[model samples]
Target chain A: MTKRVFKAAFVSSLPVLMGYSAMGMAAGILLAGTVKLKFLPFWAFLSSGINISGALQFIMVNWTEALLPLTQVALLTFCLNVRYAMYGFSLIEKFRPLPWLKRGYLIWSLTDETYALEVDSAARTPAGENQLDFCLGVAFLDHLYWLIGVTAGAVIGAALPFDSRGIDFAMTALFLVVLTDQCQSKINRLSAAVGIISAICGRVFFSTSNMLIPAMVMMGAVFIIFRGKFERKPEQKEGEE
Target chain B: MSRETYFLCMTLTAGVVTIALRAFPFLMFSGNRPVPPVIRYIGKVLPPAAIAMLIVYCYCSAYQDKSFASGGFGLPELAASVLVVALQFWKRNPLLSIISGTILYMVIVQNFV
Candidate 1:
């Protein structure tokens, strides 16, 4: 069991380790260089990212420029995490047994990439230790990469003196990369379409601050409306691997 | 409102709404009354739609205008998007296509275009 857990953890975490590191690197570069932010603030942002991951941090960096009040920050941070609230529903049955301390990172480390990985791996394994182990491994691995990338980006940002006009592209690139890698099925394609459409509509109709909620709600509505036809039934049993 | 106050309001609203979203769904479904057909249905495709909306959000603005329009027909962006689509469709490697296309666009835009 110990060996199995280790194996599951390592294999599941491999992608996260690779992806987050690159993304974190890009983020660090932007915050430190283009924005000319200090290391302490950058560090603060990176560590906090362990909880919410990618998008929020990017927004936070911009918000910091605006220098909003702490209450606003906490509120927005909490609200930005609403999707996780949604994701949490799908996971309650799976993690209800764990203590919040153990579940804290487990729930908190759910970046977009991490969630995709854990969800896919969990679907491949039975709803037990193997699944849990895989999920934990992915989180641990992804988090490790993010920390390293943050440090690296900070260091590099400190070193480089040029304008570094294109540093922000790193996040965009990472997103495109992770998204492309995951889009193997018709379901993924449709999901991408739905996400894009809903976000565009949401943004057009709503303020930037409020766009995410409506986007999530609309996506949720669409999914509920078409769950039966969204994807084919799972053809294989778990543990086939 | 001042920027700080506006952000503060946004922050508070986000926190309350998020906690409610997270906590409410589970409590409502705790008894397992068959997942209300409507909810279960929504669950099926919400992830995709949500992700798609985010991507579109990344490219376009709140006004629904093409962000790239200011720059005109960008070869790199074109290359990257096309590469992502074609590679994803043919080789079906979502990662490869995304990387190639995004990188192509980033590189193309950064230096040449």
Candidate 2:
């Protein structure tokens, strides 16, 4: 059963894995191009952020060398990740079903994309073949993609003469892809719209990327408060016989 | 930092976290019980909101301290944005849209930025 489910997840995540690998490459190129980093130092930077914050790791090299404000950086990161709390809330059911060891593992791989695939899949098709397989599959492949890219970026940064401008758009491209996958849903569009408005408003007022949290908070509140307006009819019909 | 020390930190931090999160769901919920209401609720709205916000923020912030000649969108970003929208609309594949957009940006940078 485990092996068969793993195959399903692997097949499902192939597209995401491809995207992640390419984007990771772009990220690597940018990290290396825009900044100087040695291999160990690079991983250390990734680790430092991973310990407390995964999003922040991506920015560590820039934040450290760019003379960006620490407070602002932290705020933006927190706001960007504020969705994690929401994701966490949703995960209680999935985790509550698991034992301690497994629950601990699931908590580790719960990034935005992983969470989306799992929640969407589970909600769309509940029961039989754990949703965790999909989450791990997506998260695992994406991580590999990132690891490969970041490691390469560190290596290439040392040797190559790649164009820095082309690489910076990686994240932009990744987000664009994610949005495409959700064209069927209206609630998602509404949620995204709220977050965008909050981000813009926060930017205008704060004029710094660091204010992402405040914007996230504002947005998250709006989502929860108005969730009823956008609520969908319960649709999950899958159950074991 | 020393290479060995740096690698150790990342292995412990990212590596361990990766292993845990990846393994989580499969291990738990092998059998089932009634899922609480809140969990069901949160699971519903997160993805769209999260993805939408991420994309918007990435685009909006890309122009923060930078200049764009007229109103401040360097040609490449503007072009890429258009391509992103059109590709996403027409192709409906996020990966294709962004990757193509990146390629476009790379191509146009010769004349633009």
Candidate 3:
């Protein structure tokens, strides 16, 4: 049973393995190139292992180099990662019955791809097989892939003398892909527009370094003001019911 | 503080904040207490907006120094971003789209401009 769950989890995580490794390598290379640290691979391992965030991995490079204020780091991290907070809502019940350590690890490693795989696995658990075991397997493998990818990239980046110009666009492309995917929903379209507009306004009014906080504040205010429009209609709720 | 210690603190801050956010729902609603509708609404709408904002931020950083008149008139960034969005929409494969777009951007900036 354990072997079956592990196999299934491995299969499910293959795509994540590819995605995390590629993206993590990009982030790690960026870090190695940007930061003048002595132990590039060590930093890569520590950051990727602890945060396990694709976007943060990229953005943190700048933060580390600039030594941005801790308060800003905390807030920016919140803005960039608030979506993760929502992910746990759908997973609360599934993880509730887990032992504290297991559940804590699951939460710690609850990245976007891992969360999607876990939710997908929940739907298709094989008979008599433990879902938590499958989830743990997926989480462990994905985390491992991420760590290996980032560390390898750091080592390679430090050794090679290749010009990395324009490579950082990978981060931009990643955000674009995520935004493109999210824009498929009608409700999401409006929110995305609000975000784009707010970000532009923030950039215009404040410097680049100080834009995101204002953008987030504007986004929250707009959502609250237009809550009636943004919220699901009663008809849709009834249909779901 | 030294650079290493500062880096360590920053990582810890980010890690702690992220774990706290992820654990918020589990801690608050573990005992069958219903989540407030406001919280639910924010959850649903926040991701798309946050992602969009991040994309904008990315662009701002990428073009921070280059003007519209210079650096290939912002063509590389715009073209690569458009390619990424279109490929993602059509193929639904993130790895393919991101790699393709990044390569295109690198080639353009490295050789063409």
Report how far residue A33 has shifted in candidate 2, in Å.
Answer: 1.7
Worst 10 residues of 1 chain A by lDDT: A232-241
Every candidate's DockQ is 0.31, 0.33, 0.76
lDDT of 3 by residue, A155-235 (tens): 888889898888888888888888888888899999999999999999999987788888888898888777877877732
> Distance from true position, residue B77, model 2, in Å?
2.0
User: What is chain B's TM-score across the candidates, in the order shown?
Assistant: 0.58, 0.61, 0.88
Off by over 4 Å in 1: A1-12, A33-36, A40-52, A55-96, A111-138, A173-241, B1-34, B61-70, B73-75, B88-99
Instruction: Evaluate chain B of model 3: give its TM-score.
Output: 0.88
Summarize candidate 1's per-residue lDDT along A1-241 as a digit string, tens digits: 3566657677666766776666666666666764434444445344434343555544544554545455545544553454555566666677666667656667656666676776676554544556676677777777677777766776787787865643444444444554565566677778778777777778889765556667766666665555555647633222211
Residue-level lDDT of model 2, residues B1-113, one tens digit each, is 54344334433534444444344334443446444554455545655565566665566555655654532356677778778878888878766787788888777765544
Q: What TM-score does chain A of model 3 get? A: 0.90
Return the top candidate by TM-score.
3
RMSD of 1: 7.8
**Of models 1 and 2, which has the larger TM-score?**
2
Q: Best candidate per lDDT, number?
A: 3
Off by over 4 Å in 3: A122-126, A234-241, B1-3, B65-70
Error of 1 at A60 (Å): 5.1
